[model samples]
Target: MTPETSAKLAETVDNCRRHAGDWELGITLMLRTHVTIDLTGGLPSVDADLAELHEIADRVGDRWTRAQVASAAGEVALSRGRYDWARAEYEECLRLAREVGAHTEVPFAIARIAESAFCSGDFDGAEQLLAEVAREVEPYGGVYDVRAYGGMLAALLALVRGDLERARAECELARAASEMIAAPPQLTAGLDNIDAVLTARAHGPEVGLAKLGPTLAAAVAAHCAERVLASLCDTAAVLLAAAGRSAEAVRVLAAATAWRAGHPRSVPEQAAVGGLPDGTRAVLGPDRYEQEAAAGAELSPAEVVTLLTGS
Candidate 1:
């Protein structure tokens, strides 16, 4: 993690530690910090902290707060690429939300589950969950994040299914919903909008590459390591391939591979694709890198872009 991120997390942790009486608020703070860390491709220490916090919430018997904590944990796990654990956490959160009738939390938990499924290549399951969330949350007023999230998921699924037209439409909807939110741009709502725009262009590597330059620049300026690494890996792979810079693509992939090695406990479904280089694996081990190297079949430039961007 960056120094700034570490300091921010430390502040949150200190506040939570000092204010133990406010278990709900403390858990929320921890969850927010955990989410930010997970999204930025940080170290594994935060996951351990979140697990401890989860135990505390369970002991306190705060069902609603526990549900939110679980949902946030699941999201962080998903961001780290831990699909199985993420799915389990999301399922637990969903059950708790149902028991407590916490309508606001249910959609978010379901959306996280959908994301897990999508990352695991279970498009049908992902689509079903997203559709359910959209239906369930529609009657509840002011759930713009849910709506935009579902649209973003729909766009990804459509793109994977080779329905470019449908993907484009969903991206437009996501962008529109994002515009209505008053929250900070780094928040989930705004990020979903940015994701939609980038995913739409992912149909063509050239277009995606052109868009990624500015997007990565912004993410770097904001100190969003996960977003920057993701954009770099995807854009570099594709642009290099398109320009016949195979060696450069290999170099970018190597760097991404190294980053993943440092966060082995992270959610595997969300990590970069194409696995580590052979030398990296000799140092990091095969289990740390999910994908195996192919001898002759290199991914097309667009496919490389999709793998990196999760589009």
Candidate 2:
């Protein structure tokens, strides 16, 4: 991160913390900050940051606010690749939202729980949860704000399921909704563009990864460590392989593998392979590999359903 950007993010964090007592305003500020950090691919240093924010929400003693806090914490945990933890948070958020009659939060929490399931490779669970969320939220008026985020999740789920055409269509819908709502342009745009690039890659290798270059460059310049790392790993892998520089690709993958190993708790398994060359799996070996792989692979659909229900 640049000095200027670092200073700005620090200022934002401080300002949000200073106004933490007002649940509505605080949640909005925190959500904005979270989006910014997420786009830049940064993760919070500790769970306690989320816990502190939740503590403030609890003090407010409003059901809606508490649900929002839980949802936000679930987002943070999901971003960190703590799928089970994310599931737990969102489950609790859902229960509280339902109990308090905060219907809006119900769909939002459901969307988040679905994302956790998708990340953990429970595709059926993700689809089931999204279907339920869509149904619940659609009746409340088909507003772009609620549906936009859910659409993005749906697009991602489609991508993971190997339905490139469906994913592209859903991504276009998400992009349109995001644009309409004036969602954080940087984050949403990058994600939409990434989906496009991935779709193109699915067509052929020689079609090249050039289309992603500028966006990836912009992400790196933005100093969003998480975004930069993901973009670099993906873009470099494809470009290097296309250029016949498999050795460099391997080296880049190695560095990425090492980085993920270093931040085991923070980096997601799918993230490590996001934009890399086909057949270029990270040789992080049996022990560490099995640990993270099981974390992603062995997650049961039932567990996801239970987590979504928060029962």
Candidate 3:
């Protein structure tokens, strides 16, 4: 994003925050919180929104709105890399959605759970959760993110299992689905990250790395931590390795790990991507790799951005 665009967004979010407690703007706040609160806001801001919305929704006895707020809270947790907390929030969202007969939200929550499951390396479990999303959304004839997330989960699962043909097919479907909908910029960023990594997997890592600086900037601007760390940074590391930049790959990996530890200490393990991890480590030599990784772990977000941007 341009600095001017980012400044405008910041101003807009500030205006939105001023009305956060207004009952008349409750639903708007609930909907807009995805980017402003979860993605862009600091922890105090997210927690405040979560507390107020969750409380007011319960007090007003509006289960549907409550479900939506619950889902957003889950997203806030997810952005912070608190996967377990996010799962719990999604479970509450599922429960409230079921109570209110919120058909669309029910599947949306399931897709979210699938995300956590994928992060945890439980591919079978993630598949099961996404199957529920698919079954539920099937009757609704494609409900935006719910439909697209199903395709994305399938794509990654196929990629992990070495089904390149299936991965490509599913990823294309996801990219199309995401583009068709008026989803949040952050949501689209997530899909785009998936697309970027898939490209690396397909042609060669050099191609992806060559274009990644702008991609990383865009994803970071969206404030989707998983997109930044898990998708972009992680894929860039793999690409660096493939391009004979093994030390650079090690540095990126360290940054990825550190970012997770600092922001989302509760996130599940970064599941192995085929032999990429082992191969990269072997190329660096174990001792040298550790030294580079330790150096990387010490870099802050600014430093990580510098490294990513090649500045």
- Poorly placed runs, candidate 3 (over 4 Å): 1-32, 37-44, 221-230, 261-269, 273-291, 294-311
Best by TM-score: 3
Model 2 stretches astray by more than 4 angstroms: 1-36, 39-42, 45-48, 185-190, 193-199, 206-208, 222-232, 235-239, 258-311
Worst 10 residues of 2 by lDDT: 300-309
- The TM-score between candidate 3 and the true structure equals 0.77
Best by lDDT: 3
TM-score of each: 0.73, 0.69, 0.77
Who is ahead in lDDT, 2 or 3?
3
Error of 3 at 289 (Å): 4.4
- Arrange candidates by lDDT, descending: 3, 1, 2
Q: Which run of 10 residues does model 1 get worst, by summed lDDT?
A: 289-298
Model 2, residue 102: displacement in angstroms? 3.5
Candidate 3 structure quality by residue, lDDT tens digits, 1-311: 34575576556556765855445455655654665553433444556656777777877677777778778888877766777777888998899889878888789889988887776567898889988888899898869677777888788787777787887888788878887787666556556666666677677777666567566776566665443444567777777888898887888777776665556322223554345557877887889888988897776555656776777
Error of 1 at 14 (Å): 3.5
**Cα lDDT of model 2 by residue, 1-311, tens digit:** 45676577567667766765466455654665465445443565434556666677867887777777777777776656778898998998999989988777788888888878877878789899989988988778755766777887787677656677887787777777777776654446446455645645675533444444444445444444553344345444555555555544555445444434343422224453554434433444345544543443333322322221233
Ranking of predictions according to TM-score: 3, 1, 2
